[model samples]
Target chain A: MNHALVSLACHAYVVAALVYLVYLVRQMDALATGGRVLVGTGLALHAVALVGLFGAQGGRPVGVAQGFSTFAFLLLTIFLVVDVCYRKPVIGAFITPLAVAVLMPGLLLDPGHVMSPDVQRPLLPVHITIALLGVAASAVATGVAVMYLLMERQVKGKRFGLLFSRLPSLEFLDTLNRRLAVLGFIALSVTLVTGAFFSSAAPGFFWTWTSKQIATLVAWAVFAALVGARSFGGWRGRRVALLTMTGFCLLLVSFLSSYDFIHVGGGAH
Target chain B: MEFLCIGLSHRTAPLGVRERLALPEARQVELLQRLAQSPNEAFLVSTCNRVELYMAAPDMNRVRESAREELQQLGGPDALEHLYEHRGEDALVHLFRVAASLDSMVLGEAQILGQVKEAFEKGQGVGAVRGELTRVCAAAFGCAKRVRTETAIGRAATSMASAAVSLASKVFDGLKDKTVLLVGAGEMAELAARHLKQAGATKLLVANRTLARAEALAAEVGATARPYEELFTLLTAADVVVCSTASPVPIFTKENVGAVGKARKHRTLFMVDLAVPRDIAPEVGELDWVHAYDVDDIQKFVAENAAARAEEAQKAGVLVAQEVARFVRDRAVRNGVPVLAQLRQRGESIARAEVERTLAAIGDGLTDKQRKSVEAMARAIVNKLLHEPTARLRSVGPEHEGNRLAGAAAELFGLEEAAPPTGAGGPNVVANGGKG
Candidate 1:
């Protein structure tokens, strides 16, 4: 039943992602409504599957597959919330496909290893939640930033094509991207602080700079500079969008590297 | 009733000829009153480009002659040469085309629909349009709306005034919170100002060399008038500026605009110079924050949009043709109404006469309930006997064959003179005076 639910959820996400793509190209209200309903249903089913997986694993997701699935679920949740609040259907075209892509690995790859008992301490859940939320917020920022760049290009180039007309205004997209970046930064800050506590609790993981940690630190520094420039230098529109995109890419790299490192090392302990 | 249209448009008439035929509001009302007295129903639509009269009359030649005489009285012999006439289905198609903007000088212009609606309303007010004219006008309005929604014919701006607004919208997100400044009170500037206001520009400032003219235009447009000397200060506050001064030299140079840009904190500015000699300096457009378009640029934009709409207009033509065919079929079905009404009246009167005779013969022996039941039976028999014929009559097409069948039915039923007589009753008597 759990496997069946997970497969259903993944298929629903793929269908929703395709509908959103069509909606972006056609700018049809019907397609947008259908896509929203599909994504909402998919998110519900995905949450149920996650709950089942956690229950099966003794009240927590225990492996890299589960972790990736949780991250994808959080990403989709944030996307739906933003999409509903903003009424910008165009962003769904970018975010839904990203969600499906992130979830694919979890659905295809079996759980090779589980986390050690020591690593599954009380602090571990808090660290994972904060980190997933942070990643989800960053994903939203990246989607919004992409929209901002497209809108800015159309405005600056004086070429109002179909994509240009479909996109939200540059000002709106820019503001949304900034807000998401701020939210993600705050979440990442909390995650890093929690991770510090968790690392101290787990032996052999204290203050050690692995490739994943270095990549994450680099992504954090880039976002810090981006937020700093926006606040202090009035950096906005195209430049801010580009910086946010760069930070998101770096964050993605860091996430994948951490997933690989943990799985290759037979789960962190 | 037969539909007929007589008019002179830009296609068939020169401007002077059309101007001569143009009727004022009072004159149109007088003509409508005259038409109301005639047996035919009629209404006139007089715009700058065309003056047309649409009517429902029994005789096409009589209505045409009367309309031609009226036009002759208004514009003399020269206007008569430009006048054209359409009859029946052609008239309906013409009205649809006009309302859909297909007949407009600039294809797909929106003003024609509003003008058509105004004429329709005026006709309704005067009781000069009813029955068939009412249905035709309503269908024309529907077709116009369908054409607008189903095709991209009306998508782009075709005039300079609207082109300016379109360009501004392309540059900015929207005009809702933008400020527009008019540097001169020229006709083109007033047009652009009205377009801007319609597009939801929040504030408007008019600056002209003549303060009185500026104030007059300001009052007209519900805007404020700033002194010509205060143009520079106004420029800093405005997001969109329209310049159309009569001055031969440049109104604002590159240096002055650069200074204004500095004061504006590098906010985006759209400038339209409608003047021939170019009101704003060409180099002013080179400034980082300022986007300027001269008259030629606006004209180019209008031309390009018009060309694009021309393609959509072809698509609109197909839609209009489909609507016209549907309307024709509907009108055809309506032609069957009178025949059906007459046939039913004939059958009902026969039933009534038979029921009365039988009731009188039965006299004192029968109960009132029994008499009523017998009468109902007689009426039911007549109704059932006439059912198939009446249904067939009502479904007849407006074609010549349908008319021939209707004539045969009238002859067979002796219904040719079946106009319901006032205060009279018989098996042959019709209902509602056969006005159907």
Candidate 2:
């Protein structure tokens, strides 16, 4: 039953992604509104699927599959919050595909057990939630940054095509990028602080410098630089956009290469 | 289908004749009232570009002569050389095109529709527009609306000032927060600046070599005057720059604009240079974050946009033609109405006489309820007998002389002696005039 809802939600997100892609080319405001409504429907279905998973697992994620599912849910939730806060609609063309990609494995993969029984339960869940939230914010930042760069190119190149009028203003996208990057950076800091306590409880795993830990710390550093430069260095537009995308690509590699961080001395799921 | 239009538009007449023939509100009402009696319906449309009289009467030729007489009297004998005439379907298509702005001096311009609507409303007020006039006007307005929504005929900018504003909107999305710098105080620069201000570019700074002239023109453009020596300083802060400086040499260079890009953090900048010698270097346009448009470039864009509208207008023209054919067919069908009425009256009378004779032969053997049923049955029989002929007449179109079909039916039935279709002196007309 849980997997079925996740699968339905995954299809919905995929369809919404297609809608946004069509809207991006057509430059129709009506199509943009349709994309927003489609995303809302996908988000509703995804929330119900997560609630059912929460009930079945007693609030603890099973393995990488459930974790990916929750990560997509948080990402979409933040995506919608930002959408409401900023009137820019073009970024959904960039954001929804990421949700679909991240949520696909949750529907297809069998979620085996991923945690050590000796791990402190409360701190582990909290640390996982914080890390997922940070990654979700970073993903949204990446989508917005991509939109900023597209608008920047259209403006500089003087094409004046559908994209030039359809995309948000460069300044608006840049400001949204900075806000999302700062939020992700703050959440990553909290996740790292909580990680020390959760991993040390599993014995001999304290600061073990595993592949996942190394990649995550590196991703965190990149986001830290992005947030710091934008806030103080008057850095904006294409340069920061490229930096955001680079950090997100690193996070993607780290996510795909490693199992859930809760696998403290546990076998790979 | 008896609709006729006679007038001299800008196409056929000079401003001398058109202006002389243009009617004031009182004169339009008087002319409409005077012509409405003989024509059965009349309306006057008098604008700067055209003065036309539209009327629905059975005699298209006689009405055309009378309308020409009225215009010639108002605009003198010179108006006769300029007058053009259309009748029936042709007249209706003309009306629809005029309402949709397809026949405008500036194709797809928006003002003509409102002017047409005003003429229509004024005609209705004086009891000069009704019946066919009302139907055609309604159809014309609907056709105009369809052209507006179904095509991008009027979405393109047609003027220099408007083209610049539209291009700015595409780049900046909206200009409420942007700064615009005007680099000259000429009339052309002020015009473009005023248009930008209207498009919500609230912050405008005007700079010219002569400070006093700059300040005076700045007041007109709703901008503050800045010193011309501080041009590069203004460039860094401005999102858009309209340059019309009368300089022989290029005042801006790649090096200067390139440095400004870094100073402004490579923000998008739109530059419109309207000078003869070109105030900004053409090479400045090559730099990233800088867009340069001169007079020729802007004019080229406007022409292309207008040509695109013209292409869309062809689609609108097809829609108007379809509507015109439908309206003509419907009007032709209405021509059969009076003849059908007379035929039914004749049939009902004959059936009643026959039924009364049969009842009288049976004497007092019938009850009151049976008598009422007998009368209803007789009426039903007559209606059944006339059903096929009525259906055929209703399908008539103007090209087939639906009026002649009505005349033939009347002559065959020995009903009211209707006028011959060759001329329109018809007595069996639905008189609906002088009633608003």
Candidate 3:
């Protein structure tokens, strides 16, 4: 597998996201179409690039470097395909940036690395897949939730104009947010269960207390509260948006702070 | 052909002028007859907001002038300025939109189709509607129905009756136990009454000038029919009074309604005069404890309904354009029949005459079998000669060479000189003709 092509694929996605963002502002449908086409092409290239990397690594690349790259790229490809197929162009306003944000980190890091024992575990691939899908679903929920809040504000003030016009109605946005959150919640719970099971079986082998763990826990709590509020308290609209954004912020913290803490020689178990 | 539309609407004229122009059942028959006598196809569509006459004639300006003259003769020319006339396709579109309720005071109103149907039937009886006017009206009605079924325009976001009920709710806070007195037998009045009843009005009363008519309406609406003698007495006790009648004069004067308010100890009264020649006097609106609203007051709320349904109305416009294109194409084909027949006849005559002359000259040299073979060869030559032009003309549409071919062939064959072209028939005829 060419390391250069993987980097190129990630960079192409980022460029596509930027183009889509420009279209969101200019509202040029032609630019939007171009962005969609670029994203689609990038997704196909990214999928092939992952396959190449997997082939180079023997069978399934479930180790540290390859696992992260595969997880990030696979999640993004799935998200982009769903987003494009749904005919909801406005969603790109939120999702494209998120896609770039997740993929850029892995792209910047070393593409190839010697496989470690922790990375080559039996349950590693399943764990990464679950975690990646959970994160992707949460990202979508976060986007819809933000849109819901904006729409709710506009509705309350009765100042419906461009932002309000571009977004789905409060009812529709809230519904989407809730549904995505539920899916993400299920995936997160499965990942958590798998992680706990593997840690019990191979004690102290895959343990961590890095800044990443804390931030991920915080995200989980925020989303859990959101789901609970939705079911029991009937929390929706602006409230749901606030919770989603909070969870998303935690995700960013986990991604950034873990790298920082590890550089500062933080504990791994 | 002239596309003249004239009459009073809620916008240009007040209820008084509108009522004067409003054609009652008896007067509509006579007015329709008068319009038919003038060589124009007249269509009278009378709704609560408007009383418009859509006509088709050869001279549109002359038709417009005559429409004003007719209106003046019927309801006086002082109301002439309130009239509006749209010509040709504009008129056609306007009528289609109106029948579809896109141009209605309440957009996508279901009531308009029935009103149009009634107008069509009345015009048919008086012979004011024939040809294209009748077809356009019926098509417009059908188009309106399709728009209603296909789009969410008339899904009752808000209607005039609902608006009235909403206002009544604001006045009463809650409509429960309110007594409603409907002082007319018109469809609008009946609809308003039904809305009030749905809003939880306990008692309903109908008081018209004609007791039997009032009784008939009251029976249908589950209301009591009080005689005209007890009108003021009933008005005093009723919490709401909805007035919509075809009366020439004012039905509820300030003196009578004001006096009734005094007798009722100044209990608050919500009076909705849904009439054209306003049932309640304008001054009565200022009476103590009487909250009176005329048709004009309802315009803003009704306008919102129009705004809400604008998208669906736009869709209907597209449908109308599609239908119009189809209609014109069909008419062109039917009109080209004579031309096609004449061309075929002329070609056959030329082929038969030449063949006969040749055969006579060569009669001694040719046997019977050989003569038959020559006749067959001559027929094949005629078919080959006519095939290309006939195919080209048939393939041509109205927008392109079809009209040109028809006109050229007509002149070449002297068909127009022999017989004049007929008028455009009603939609039913066109639809059936198209089917054939």
Candidate 4:
């Protein structure tokens, strides 16, 4: 039943993403409302599914399917909250589809997977939560950067097509990108700190400096520079958007490299 | 009652004819009042581009003749050449299109809808709008509102000044935070300055070679005047620059823009060059700080405006058609009203005559109480017999079946007066309404 909820939510997110893409090309109130309402419904269903999984697992999600489901949930929650606040559901064209892709592994694959009991350290969940939060924020910023570039091109090139008119102002996208980058940076800083403590305290887990960790460090530096340059140096426009996009690519590399698969019923404890 | 629309638009007439036919406030009230006598309800929408009068009545011939007379009197000899008229559903559709701006000179413009609303309000005040015109206008306004919201019909503004402001908005988030610098006091510059001001540019500066002329233009537009010598300084402070000077050579150079780029932290700048020889150098546009569009480029945008919104406009047109269809179908029920009224009148009179004869045959045995009861029973029998026909005509039918049934009932009842005017109910547009 919980998987059914996840499946339903996934379908809703897919449809919402498509509607938002159409809206990006040709804006209309009905399309925006469709996208918003579907995202809202999917988020509600996904939240309930997550709570059900928590009850079944005694608190945290149990397997790889549950883990990625939780990650996709974080993505949708962050996206919907910020979109509602900023009134920019157009960016959902990028974010909701990514959420659907992330949720697909959990929905399509056989459900059971497990890892070492030590990998389930209580502190690790906190780190995962903060890190996923950072990832979602950075992903949203990346989407906004893409929008900024598209608008900047049309304004510079002077095409003035439907896409040009449908897009929000370049400055608005740039401002939103900067704010999201800073927010991601703050969340990521806490994530790195919490992850370090988890690594040091958990048994059989050590600071090995894996490729994922290196990429995380690199992404963190890029975002720090972005937030720092924007705040102290008053940097804006294309440069900021470019840097945020770069950071997002690095973060993607870290997420994919670090995404470990477990043997089905690997037997915890 | 059938709806009618007659007059001249920019499509059918030139500016001279439109201007000659345009009605002022006083003239509009007088015209509406004159046209709105008992049986006819009228509305007049008089703008610079079009002067159209909408009316509804059962007797369309008399109304059309009066409308032609008014047109001839108001527009003189040219009114006959450019006149077109729409009747019945066609007139209602035309109103829907006009209110949605689909029939505007510049398709999807925002002003026509407001002008239509203003005319409607004036008609309401003049007491010239009743059943049919009121229902049709209300639907027109609703369809306009939906077209505006459900489609991007009004997103593209199609004038040079409006294009500049719209492009500026694409770069900057809003004009309220940006400063606009006008480099000349020409008509184009003055026009763009007013547009920018209307678009909510709080800080506007005018700089021209003739500072006095600049000051006068600035005063007229509620802006500050600056010396042309401080042009580069103004450029540094301003985010949008409009150059309309008559300079033979380029007034600005790439080197000057490159130098000013650092002063403003390379903030995005938009410049519109409206001069004949081009006020700003074309090379200045190559610099990273600015995007400059000359007169041709702006005009190109103007020409592309309608084509760009073609898809959305098509969507709005479909929406308007659907709304018009729904209104027509809803209004078809009213077609049966006259027939039902005639049927009730004939039946009640026949019943009264029959009841009196029967009572006379029954002789003096019938008391006053019995006579009243017999009369009441006769009226009840007529009403009961008319119920099914009335209900069928009023409801239960296909698109045009209600009206057809009503006409058939009128014929069956031998009510000659209930028939509609011949050749008048069909939708028709006559180009030669004005007889000189």
> Which ranking of candidates, highest DockQ first?
4, 2, 1, 3
Winner of 2 and 3 under TM-score: 2
Question: DockQ for each candidate?
Answer: 0.10, 0.14, 0.01, 0.37
* DockQ (model 2, Cα): 0.14
What are the candidates' interface root-mean-square deviations? Answer: 3.7, 3.5, 14.8, 1.6
Residues B194-256 of candidate 2: C-alpha lDDT, one tens digit per residue = 788789989999989999999999887678999989989999999998887666567888998
Query: Which structure among the candidates has the greatest DockQ?
Result: 4
TM-scores of all predicted structures: 0.56, 0.58, 0.55, 0.59
What range of 10 consecutive residues in model 3 chain A has the weakest lDDT sum?
A: A260-269
Query: Which residue pairs clash in candidate 3?
Result: B2-B57, B15-B276, B131-B424, B131-B425, B135-B426, B135-B427
On DockQ, the stronger of 2 and 3 is: 2
Residue B428 in model 1: lDDT: 21
* Candidate 4 residue runs with Cα over 4 Å from true position: A55-64, A203-206, A262-269, B1-158, B307-436
| Candidate 3 per-residue C-alpha lDDT over B1-436 given as tens digits, one digit per residue, 9 for 90 to 100 | 3455677777677766777777677787777776665456887887778888888765456667767787887767678777776665566667777777777667776787888888888787777887666667767777777788888887854356767776565446456677889998878878887888888887999998899989998988889999988888898789888988877677877888888755776666888887777787877766645667777666654664355567777887798766655554555565565566666777788888988999888868998899888888888898898787677667767452554566666666554542323544321111222211
Cα miss at B381, model 1 (Å)? Answer: 73
Tens-place lDDT digits, model 4, residues A1-269: 88899999999999998998898877788888899899899989988988877765545655557666777888788888877887876778778888888889868766645433444467665676677778878888887888888888887787777667778888789888888898899988998888788777866666777877888889999999999998777688888888998998898787656555446333231
Number of the predicted model whose lDDT against the real structure is largest: 4
User: So what's the TM-score on candidate 3?
Assistant: 0.55
lDDT against the true structure, each candidate: 0.75, 0.75, 0.69, 0.78
Candidate 4 structure quality by residue, lDDT tens digits, B1-436: 6678998876787655765776657888998999987557889987655789998876677888998899989889878789999987788888999999887645676767877988888988988876557778898999999998888777764345677787778877888988899998976777788789888998999999999999999999999999999999999999899987766567888888889888887887889876555678878888865888875566455556667677887898899889987776565565556667778989999999999899999999988999999999999999899989988878835455665676577678876555442222321111111111
CAPRI grade of model 3? incorrect
Model 1 DockQ (Cα-based):
0.10
Model 4, residue pairs in steric clash: none
Clashes of each: 0, 0, 6, 0
Tens digit of per-residue lDDT, candidate 1, span A39-94: 88988888898887676555655556676788788988998888789787888999
